[model samples]
Target: MEIKDSVVLVTGANRGIGAEWVHQLRERGAAKIYAGARDPRSVVCPDDRVMPIALDVTARGQVLAAAELANDVQIVVNNAAVSYRQPLIGGDVDRIHAEFETNVFGLVYVTEAFAPVLRANGGGAIVNALSAVSWFSFPGMAGYSATKSAAWNLTDALRLELADQGTLVVALHSGAVTTPMGDNFPIDKIEPTQVVSAALDGLQAGQTEVLADDISRVIKSTLTSDPSRYAAILGG
Candidate 1:
């Protein structure tokens, strides 16, 4: 779990949170970072230790190919996701499915593809990029929130399934992040680095879940007791 000298792979590395993950991992002295995006050319980071890879997470073939190519990876960061801001009652079915495909299924494809690689490399770690919405759904982005909710369970399942292999699975959650996905959010947004730093620290600390912001932490604390408390935060 030590970032220093560890070989890692971060999906959606072209921009936003994924881009910051690569930068922070490098700052922490990661030996190498396989920066995966749909187009490797989109990864504009100038770090020599950052190796760009063509990875469209929704594509099973690309996911498997990435595992084969980045065989030395000790940590897999599942950061590739898309949010359509679609709602449940009236949202387009195709967009909702697309969100699930990238957010939930993408994590599945990556974990399935890399579980063996992790075991072979001494039981590494899998860090999934989740959201506070995984705990409670708000309006506007209902479909996106549903995908994260599914991703939360998927992360838990992967953790249990990969435990025998010694892979550490961690779910990192945040509220409004200042990424393209959060630009339209009406709430205050935290910098992507804030979430990335907390996630990495949590991974090193061996935490199964990381609450990266006040909203995420609060939601986690009250989810089982009073799920409706989130209503106040969301202006409900």
Candidate 2:
């Protein structure tokens, strides 16, 4: 769908790629932007067209409330995510649960609540911020990687399920992003604009999945190999 003049709701709009999504969507002429953050006051609206929403994607009540409030939304950008430096096993179990709560279930709640909203608004689009980790487990970030892998599956399943309604479901995959999320990475990272621009380009072209960087493309391409090669890329 053309972003120009469309109404959009982006979760985790306070910082990182979500913040860039707000900026780029505005640049693309979106008529209204509902910027959602855990603390509504943290959302910096650039204009009256940008509405701040108090949303914690992990909270089903908040997700449903946002859907109710942004009834005219034509696009939903699920950009909220949390990660931990813990492994899937033998690490901080609390951190692992927190990761799943925000990264996996949070996304599921947002998609479910907004599926009908999008359907009501003539079957719009859903943009999910996935990662290269969605394709392979990073060395020490196994817990975070598992949630991303779950997100990847949901992205694919959502595309198939929402297809009949003409709702476009897009999976945006990238490597290290130059955001707080990418902090301390030993490898190169892409700017937030790079990620948002690529995603918008794909969304405009009606693509169901977008590899926002060469690293993501490489990770995806090597998925069928017996042993994934991303470990080597990260010097694992």
Candidate 3:
């Protein structure tokens, strides 16, 4: 669906990809953009069309409140995520829980809260910000990778479930970007705006999934290759 004059809700919009989404949507002439963050005051979108909303996606009450506030919203962007640098088997359990809380469960909860809203609004779209690691595991961040993988599957399931409602479910996958979350990584990273731009473009084109960068594209294409070769690339 076209973004022009469309009402959009974006989670974790205080900065990074979410902020970029808000900016890009405004530039595309969105009717209103609800910028959802834990601290609404931190959202710095300059346009009057932007509405900063206090939302903690993991909290059902907060998600419900956001849904009420953004009642006119048709597009929901699930962007909030936490990356705990730990393993799935022997990692810090608290960290793993925190990661799943924000990255996986939070997205699912927020999606559930917004599903009816989208349906009521005449069938809209849901854009989930996933990761390239959803397809390939990285050492020290296996837990995070697993959450993203689960989210990818959730997006698929949601697509099937929401088909009758005509809600377009789009999954966005990308390698590390030049955001606060990727500051510790040394590899070359794409700009957050570039990633968001590509994703929104794909949404406009009615794509079900968006590979936002070269790394993501390469990783996805490699899925058809020998499993052992792909596993070797992840240093398994």
Candidate 4:
């Protein structure tokens, strides 16, 4: 899982945390980076080591193509996701489907396509960009939170499934990050660079999960506490 000399692929690399991963990976001496985006032309990294690949994680064909093209990738970062802030009750179900399409199923598609490639490359690592909401729910973000919760369990399953192949599945959880995705939220946010840095550090150190911010750490710690305690906070 050493970043140095590793060939990595990051989904949704056109912007946000994915873009930061490309930058930090280059700084860590990654030999090559396949920056997968829905529109490859949108990838803006200046590093020569970066190769922009057209990939839409929700599309199986595109995911397969990316897996074929980036066969040398030793690390796969599942950073592509969508979030729709809407309540579960009386909310547009379409929005929930959209979030799950990108956040949950898209992740599954990407990982499935790349599992063999990772095994071929000496069982590298898969880093999933999860969220603190995976452990707790917020009113307006019910759908987004549910998708992340699904992704959290998915990561755990993948870890066990890929263990025989030596592939390390790492889940990175955090609250809002300073990106377009977090702009609407007024809460304190972690810089994208900081999230990427902590994730990569955890990956190299063979950690299964890395809580990238205080909110994430706190939320995770409360997972085993009495439900009523958090229920009161959620106004249930």
Candidate 5:
């Protein structure tokens, strides 16, 4: 679906890729944008076309409230997520659970609440900000990787289930981005604008999955390979 003149809602829009998406969507001629953040006051977009909404996706009440307020939305961007750095087995289980709360359950809640909204608006689109880690695990980020993997599956399942409704479900997978989420990671990072652009482009082109960067593409290519080989790489 064309983004021009569409009403779009982006979660985590206070900063990072979500913020970039809000700006780029405006540039693409989006009629209205609901920028959702834990603290709506933190959203810096000053346009009247941009409405900042208080939304903590992990909170069911906030999610439902945002959905009600943005019922005219034609597109929903699930960009809010949390990451906890630790090993899987002996890791901080509490932190891992927190990560799942925000990254996995939050996403599900938001999508479920907005599914009907999208249907009412004539079957629009849902964009999920996934990660390269969704395809491969990384040391010290095992919990984060697991959540993203679950999100990837959720995206796929939603795509299939929402097909009859004409709701386009798109998943964008990439390596670390130049955002707070990428802090302390020594690897090269892509700009948030690049990720947003690629995802919007894919949405316009009717793509269900967008591998937004080289790292994501490379990791996805390994899915068909011997599981042991990929496991060794992650283990090392």
Candidate 6:
């Protein structure tokens, strides 16, 4: 849980939240950061602690290879995700499939591949990047919401499953961040650096879930009493 001198791996580290996580981790004095990306060459930070690693989370072979390469990694930040602006009933099936491939299935693959490594290293921790959409409906991001909801449950399951091994699992849910993923939205967004910084602090403090923005904090607090409030947007 300690970020200082921790060996960490961050997926989708080329840009957006993932890239910000890499930078923040270095600032936290991480011993090494495996910056996992589809094209590792794109990671341009000059820090020696940053190790750019080629990893396509959707590909089983690539994931296994990355695990082999970053054998010392004790903490994992599953920050890679894909979102397609599509409604469940009206969206293209191909787009929905694509989102699931990266957002849900890919996360599962990465976790599976890294589980042994984490256990071997004395069971450190896993932090999954989720979204506020998992708690409430967004008009055109139903597919993304569905996948993130699955990821949220996945985080819970992993937490319980890995508990005996002493591994900590943290699920982070938040409204849009000021990254490429939220560039098209008009809502107020938190900076990616701030989001990642808060996440690291929460992890070290042994928190299970992190609501990185006010919107996410309010949604999580209100979900139990007003689950139906989200249905209003879905026309329930």
lDDT of 4 by residue, 73-102 (tens): 999999999887667999999999999999
Query: Can you give the TM-score per candidate against the true fold?
Result: 0.96, 0.96, 0.93, 0.95, 0.94, 0.94
What TM-score quantifies how close candidate 3 is to the native fold?
0.93
lDDT of 2 by residue, 1-236 (tens): 89999999999999999999999999999999999999989888878998998999998998999899999999999999987775556899998888899998999999999999999899999999999989788778888889999999988999999999989999999999998989835589999999999999999999999999989998888886566385657755
For 1-236, candidate 6 gives per-residue lDDT tens digits of 89998999999999999989988888889999999999989996777888999889999999999998888989999999987765688679998888889999898999999999999999999999998877776767888888898889999999999999889999998888888888644467888977897799899999999988877877777676465765433336
Superposed by TM-score, candidate 5 places the C-alpha of residue 90 at a distance from the truth, in angstroms, of 3.1
In order, the Cα lDDT scores of the candidates are 0.91, 0.90, 0.88, 0.91, 0.90, 0.87
Candidate 6: Cα lDDT at 1: 84
Residue 118 displacement (Å), model 3: 0.6
In model 6, what is the error at residue 220, expressed in angstroms? 0.9
Model 5: what TM-score?
Answer: 0.94
What ordering of candidates by lDDT runs from best to worst? 1, 4, 2, 5, 3, 6
Global local distance difference test of model 6: 0.87
Q: Candidate 5: how many backbone clashes?
A: 0
Give the TM-score comparing model 1 with the true structure, all chains together. Answer: 0.96
Q: CA shift at 181, candidate 4, in angstroms?
A: 0.9
TM-score of 4: 0.95
Mind giving the per-residue lDDT tens digits that candidate 1 earns over 91-159?
A: 799998899899999999999999999999999999999999897876788888889999999999999
Candidate 6: regions farther than 4 A off: 224-236
Which of the two candidates, 3 or 4, achieves a greater TM-score against the reference? 4
Error in Å for residue 5 of model 2: 0.3
Between candidates 2 and 5, name the one with more favorable TM-score: 2
lDDT of 1 at 191: 98
Model 3: per-residue Cα lDDT over 1-236, one tens digit each: 99999999999999888888988998899999999999999999696899999999889899998898788999999999877665568879888788889999999899999999999999999999999888877667887888898999999999999999999999999988898887634466889988899888999999999998878888887775366745534445
Q: Which ten residues in a row have the lowest lDDT in candidate 6?
A: 226-235
Each candidate's number of clashing pairs is 0, 0, 0, 0, 0, 0
